[model samples]
Target: MKILIAIDGSKASGLAVKSAIGLAKAMGKPPTLVLMHADVPLMRRVAAELGTEGTRRYHQENHDHAMKSARTALKRAKLAFSEKLVVDDAGPAIAKAAKGGKFDLVVMGSHGRTALASALLGSVAAKVLSQSTVPVLIVR
Candidate 1:
């Protein structure tokens, strides 16, 4: 089965990845895993301070950290999955990516954060549920 695993370097996202791997193994098909890291734009001050090259370097560092965290999490679960990174915020970008990619399942984490907290935290899983055509399996 094809699975789009949304991760944001959170503990919850790690759980979701583990859950997806377990599901894939249970089904006897190691899923075609597509990992995504949505790049949340930085603050204006931070951007200005970083300037062009510095900002680019900062973004690259963030991307590398996200990828490294994802790889470590997947590795701990012993799951093999391909990865992709997008230069957009988590919510809308994740939904768009999942739909455009035609994934069968959009596996993600359920943050216990409430509406206000979710808004502040930028809940990609919630947005994916709202907009994605594919079925979502949320691992809390």
Candidate 2:
């Protein structure tokens, strides 16, 4: 099985990674794991000020920061995996990657927002559920 875990540098995201690790242990044979981080683009003004190289560096830094915790956890578990970082909206980007990569499962963390709050603020997990072709497992 191929599993894609979304890492967003949040405590909730850590739970998602931990849950995936537990899945690996239960399955006996570790499945293929892919770590994905989707970072939103910087504001136009900031990007313009930074220029191309600086913009690239900014993205790289954000990606590195977001992946650090998840990467460390995976490494400590002695698991083999790969990572992908995209500069786009987290919800759609994750959905696209999960479907395009043909992953059997997409694991992610949720904020557990209420219906009214989620409706008002918008929810990444909800968007992925609506848009993704692949099945998703949400860990809170």
Per-model lDDT? 0.81, 0.94
| Count of backbone collisions in candidate 2 | 0
Task: Kindly report which residue stretches of model 2 are placed more than 4 angstroms away from their true locations once superposed.
Answer: none
**Which residue pairs clash within candidate 2?**
none
> Can you write out model 2's per-residue Cα lDDT over 26-120, one digit (the tens) per residue?
89678999999998999999999999999999998998999999999999999999999999999999999999999999999999999999999
In model 1, where do residues sit more than 4 Å from their true spots? 43-52, 76-78, 119-122
TM-scores for candidates 1 onward, in order: 0.82, 0.96
Give the RMSD in angstroms, all C-alphas superposed, for model 2.
Answer: 1.0
Alpha carbon deviation, residue 99, candidate 2 (Å): 0.7
Worst 10 residues of 2 by lDDT: 21-30
Worst 10 residues of 1 by lDDT: 61-70
